[model samples]
Target chain A: MAATYELIYWPGAPGRGEHIRLALEEAGASYSDTARLDAQKCADIVWAQMSDNNLGDKNTSPPYAPPILKDGDLLISQTPNILMYLGQRLGLVPSTPEENDIYKINALVLTALDGLSNEVHDCHHPIAKELYYEEQKTEALRRSKEFIKTRLPKFLAYFEKVLKGEASGNGPWLYGGTFTYADLVLFQICLFQPQTDSQNLASSVYRKRDGVREKS
Target chain B: MAATYELIYWPGAPGRGEHIRLALEEAGASYSDTARLDAQKCADIVWAQMSDNNLGDKNTSPPYAPPILKDGDLLISQTPNILMYLGQRLGLVPSTPEENDIYKINALVLTALDGLSNEVHDCHHPIAKELYYEEQKTEALRRSKEFIKTRLPKFLAYFEKVLKGEASGNGPWLYGGTFTYADLVLFQICLFQPQTDSQNLASSVYRKRDGVREKS
Candidate 1:
């Protein structure tokens, strides 16, 4: 029997886990989405499997957080890592060396999306998650502004180059002629900005500067 | 003519950039390490070229940050992205579907390293980089403790599975036999922790862990 894929991620917010869901959805793969496993249940599993004292005769793999994928006996974690694993299985990645590099680039784009998510989380919790976003609103605003002015443009321009580069051939997608995981992630980034008040800031920069278009 | 790999990173601290450097060194590739490019130099060449306003007609890929790899017409960024690119080129990665998944797993390990680095940076500037470490010392202490107790084991156990799992039999390296960029990154992570204060805390929780012996 073929290995079944089990995706474990938080229930709501469609955050990082959404990227994996998008890929699986696009591929029409037969997978189980266990949305929002009880936080305590998840924490208990993590502690039982990952605790230092429990290291005897156990499976050894370091998964920092969820959005992990289990295919038969193979359990993998990390967002881009999981995506890359799925990209290959789903034919989302290319075949040849040159084409494979494009897939690698797409994975990097997804990794950047992860970085952006971290930044967003930080915006509301600049001090610490231990404290409420209300406690850090002033600091969050300052940091958010810097992120808008500096970081957002830096990341956006990077993708624009991928879109316009020779590899893309003036194509709409970041890779070859077809859309890949990179496109999914780019779409997600654009979708997420509005929730964080970064949409307006990005639009102003992208608009004032002609030649770049929002496709998806 | 072969294109020399040009790497741009901050001058002194290895930080994120070191992972790229280690891969290049292990591959025995000829490359230039350009560091300490201040705001002016960054503007004159790095930032200007990467910016949309200055991209002009150049067909090169844009890099989001330092440790970018410039190979002929191709310019790649993000540490794990660069390593994945180099891993294939240098034959550090295997050439089978299963092996390729292992390579992807190795890249994921690097991603974990990146996350750990972020946490370490937060230890000093927990609230925000805008504030001094002294201001957020209390919060940093709490966050750092959580990281040591919970995060370290979670990450290490994942690696232990990859190491012990019968992907290629219980072997030394991450992908079984070969020493890929992942191993280099794993080594770097171990080295970096001591430089920061994380070593002392992580040791108590993760010192006797399995599969960690290979890393040692």
Candidate 2:
């Protein structure tokens, strides 16, 4: 079957785009990644799509950032929002309306990405994204220490407790007694941590591939 | 009807909770503000709910942070996720699947809050959220300037263009020719801006309550 989805994100970096890629991978969904095709052209396309006078067909609303997913005529951005839509279409969520489970799973996905992903990004760019990492190293070190000591432990412990809850049915999944998009999201975030750190994660959840923890 | 919705957050500050409050107010929805009732008690409740062994009915998963909404058995956190769920329940979104309009509107809301509210909060705590503002004043000043110069203008202009797009129908509404949650979210974020800065926003969308611009 032909890929029905097109993802446009920064080239050579598994930053925000990793979360979406993991969801696609878990779903085994066919998709084209523009960044991996031609980095320069992908960057050009991303910039064009973000502009007020984008080069595409004029009616589509401009995407405000990269890591955009194009499905037929729809263009969606924001990591969690994209994941929410894809989780439904890809059967990565509970296929029932019981207990408002979609919202529950979505809330978990949002919290995981916010703390593990967004805050980590901020640690590297504490002063400004416009500034280089070297320029913000002092602030980055401080922020990172606080994040690991305080926020990281809290988030990890919360998810650990969640996994043990009845919602998971004592399974490794985060919800519905089955693997869902929330698991894929958490798995992807764990991949970003160092091997030792990921190994030390509360739930012993990180998977090993070929003697090295695989990214994405 | 009595307010069945319970909102828990830090007191004496608008912060992200204001976005939820604005959505409720705009929909004329009845909801309890626990933080506003007794700030200390509310803080205690929030902390308890966030703990690994939270003193709650054990089935519900712990919220990773505050600004949680408890409606019956469901407890949700993450400002945008909470707002997204409420937007649908309160009829604050375009009530249709046409054109993937809901996702489009939600993407805009996420972008607005991420750049404006999230980044703005980071400006004062560039080094660490645990640190005092005085400790990070120099870094905060630097980040704030970049935010004011680059991020603020970019976010404002993008939303202004979104308002003018075909989805908006050349009106203040952001999607499907109706006042939706996206508008309420944007309006609330604008309220957080300084009076002069909010007035100078690219779009003439912010309104005055009681014939005066109300600062959140």
- Candidate 2, clashing residue pairs? none
The reply for model 2, stretches above 4 Å from the true place, is A55-60, A97-99, A195-201, A205-216, B55-59, B95-99, B195-201, B205-216
Candidate DockQ scores, in order? 0.26, 0.52
For model 1, the docking class works out as acceptable
Instruction: Identify the candidate with maximal DockQ.
Output: 2
TM, chain A, every candidate: 0.75, 0.87
lDDT tens per residue, model 1, B1-216: 543788876666777788888777777888876664664564455555555654323333445555667776677766777777777787666554354455344545555565556666766765555667787677678667766765655565455555554542355666545556666777667653442354444342233232344443
> What TM-score does candidate 1 reach?
0.72
Best by lDDT: 2
Supply candidate 1's per-residue lDDT for B151. Answer: 60
- lDDT of model 2, residue A175: 73
Error of 2 at A98 (Å): 2.1
TM-score of chain B of each: 0.74, 0.87
Model 1: share of real contacts kept: 0.15
lDDT of 1 by residue, A1-216 (tens): 552788777665576789788888777888876664777675566455444444222333445466677787677766777777787778775554364455345445655664566776777776555667787677678667767766665566566555655555455655654566666666665653443454443443233223223331
Q: How do the residues A64-121 of candidate 2 rate in per-residue lDDT, one tens digit apiece? A: 8888998977788888889989999999887764656777888889888887788888
Kindly give the stretch of ten consecutive residues in candidate 1 chain B with the minimal lDDT sum: B202-211
